[model samples]
Target: MIETSTSICEVIAKLRIAREAPYYGREYAFGELWNALDRLDDREADDESR
Candidate 1:
């Protein structure tokens, strides 16, 4: 759980950094971050359903 929390925090930080950037990579980074969060949400939902 600690590791997962840490990873989520890291992804959030990356999202913030990407949002601040003024380049083309920002969109890609945001997409990746969104996907990561989506996966995490799916996992949590599955866990809850179980």
Candidate 2:
């Protein structure tokens, strides 16, 4: 799960910097993606604790 979240984060970071990125036009998409990754990371940490 951590790997999945990390990979997603990496891709998001790339999209944030890409020339044709639509994040500037559709900022909510970026926000949603980031929040999703954060949730995934939090869920993974919670599972590890349990």
Candidate 3:
């Protein structure tokens, strides 16, 4: 899901950059998103290994 993650990351990055972004105001959310994506990737990898 590289395409999906890339697109989402782009939008999230944009939001994180804007000071007026309500949800993105908490910068930790950005890292959380990355972590979540990593977890999803790991899960997918595990599934593929099965």
* Highest lDDT model number: 1
Model 1 worst lDDT window (10 residues): 1-10
Worst 10 residues of 3 by lDDT: 13-22
TM-score of 2: 0.50
Cα lDDT of model 2 by residue, 1-50, tens digit: 65666767765764565535574755665665667667667777787897
Q: Name every residue pair that clashes in candidate 3.
A: none
Write down the lDDT of every candidate, Cα atoms only.
0.77, 0.65, 0.62
| RMSD of every prediction | 2.1, 4.2, 5.2
TM-score of each: 0.65, 0.50, 0.49
Superposition error at 41 for model 1 (Å) = 0.7
The better candidate by TM-score, 1 or 3, is 1
* Tens digit per residue, CA lDDT, model 3, 1-50: 67557656755665555535467455765665666567667766776887
The Cα error of candidate 1 at residue 42, in Å, is 0.6
Sort every candidate by lDDT, greatest first. 1, 2, 3
Question: Which tens-of-lDDT digit does each residue in 3-30 have in candidate 1?
Answer: 5686688678878977887798888888
